[model samples]
Target: MDPWQAGLARELIMRLPAGADSAAAGSVLQPEQLDGWSDLDLHVDLPRSAEPVDLLAGLEIWSVTEEASADRQVLRAVITDGRRVDLVITGGGRVRLPDRAPDNHIRALVAQAAAKLGRGDRLIGLHLTLELVRHCLVQAMLLRDRDQGTTIHRSGSARDALADEIAGLDLDDLGVTPRPNVVERTVDLYARWRSELEPDYRPDWSGLRAVIDRGLAGR
Candidate 1:
């Protein structure tokens, strides 16, 4: 962890309100790999009486908003100190996944990449695109395994397979367009792999293309 992150994490822990079992998560617990841009994640086990929004808002850091999640209340905000914070609040029950985590990751990356493209930041957008492709490949492998009656998480072999498949593709050819040919190809790839697990499933990339186009127009 960066020295500053360690100090800030300690301060955040001390600032936790009473009557709830709260602990630092994410990079806060892994000092060696913590980076400057890493957000501070806090997982809180709270009772019904405690209002999570009020508690986080009381910190006077920034305005907090609740995101729509089918599972539990998710409070998000960026503190004045430039550290993003995500507080996952629960009432003792675990929140089950509405969909696979890899799909959610791709959606988030698409949004972030669109924003970066809007700002005319090609480097970050490309980087995010690369991550999206990698995750898609991993998701494909996971689904493939599930079909064979062997549930397996992402492993090195899966990643290697993805690397081999895309070894000849020119990732740099992707430009700052909402509906880049590469992105369309990626969506097709995702659909092909996902169909192995979900015969009738298809991803909605039109909305993502619109978001990217909007970003480019803003640029």
Candidate 2:
């Protein structure tokens, strides 16, 4: 981590209210490998009621967006220095996702995302696309396990696999996934690997494409 970023983190840790527990996650935990592009990921647990947003006061905040709930708050902020911070504050009511089989999960997620695009929900559509790149694609690659001449089981792996999964796609900050058909191209790449990994199962690629078409066409 940059010394300045580290100092900012320490400042955050120090400013937490009494009885609250906080720790660094993601790249912050690995100080030695920290780079200019890395962001600060902080998870905080609050025992008593407190304003979590108060933590960023007086900082060079460029933009901030948050999700608030009875039990949790998620803050995603960008510093004036261009680094991003993901801060999750939650209590005993923390949520968790159920375990899912890899192939089935990917299929479901892709279909849902494409359908979301068709419904003019571009933000969610892009979010799901990146999610697939960061996670589902990695899962599909490792599950294959044959080409490597070694068994693969974990989520982390070579960078080349990830690059291959996201090839030929222009990821945008806003939710406009058009030109060269980003959704179709990404799905095509995934379906190729998925076919080899689970030949018995089939995903509804065309159906979702129709949804995207209708949504983009404003029907």
Candidate 3:
């Protein structure tokens, strides 16, 4: 339910040549429920009388690859706006929610990232660390939302929840100021996000912090 993707999907359906019955999407993004690391799983149906070529004609696309399928027509595309989309055209269906990375999978990768840093493999370690922060966490958040009945979707939508968690903090809250250092702040943020998941299934926050602290000890 990402507003952007949802709007785009609607625009997509409306623009289709008449007789297009419905559009659908799923997985990853439920903006109200979970707008996190997910993709635009958009699908629409072309009327039996309409040709894909006709539907594609005059539509702006940056690049696309035709996917061969025995049942439906598929096109993997990067639209003009740089949004990657999968155009799945079939008979018709209603537009649905738009799209999990598992917790253990990310935990394992983060562990590798930590180990890499500990071993002086700075480049790979940094790569993993940054990717986890920027991308993987959102996926994990989305999964958590699904598990928790869609109460929290992503970091963007959880401002209220975050505020509640730190309601009466000092003016120089770590979320705002560099309380101790970036590493400690990172640990704190992870601790907050980790709470949304089942304790047993959550990542080892303390373990992660220890690795990072050790990894960055010398420089």
Query: Which has the greatest TM-score?
Result: 1
Candidate 3 regions with alpha-carbon error over 4 angstroms: 32-37, 53-60, 92-219
Clashes of 1: 1
Cα lDDT, all candidates: 0.55, 0.59, 0.47
Give candidate 2 misplaced runs (Cα > 4 Å): 50-53, 92-219
lDDT of 1 by residue, 163-193 (tens): 5656545566666543454555565566667
What is the Cα root-mean-square deviation between model 1 and the actual structure?
12.0
Ranking by TM-score: 1, 2, 3
What does candidate 3's lDDT look like per residue over 1-219, in tens digits? 234557666766666666665555664254544222223566666545522434444444434555455456676543343344567777632222111123434443454554554454567756665655544355455545665676645444443454443332332321211323323433355545665544554444443443344334421
What pairs collide in candidate 1?
1-31
How well is each residue in 9-96 modelled by candidate 2, as lDDT tens digits?
7888887766778888886676776544355788888664523236777665544555688778787665444445678888743322
Which sections of candidate 1 miss by over 4 Å? 1-102, 143-165
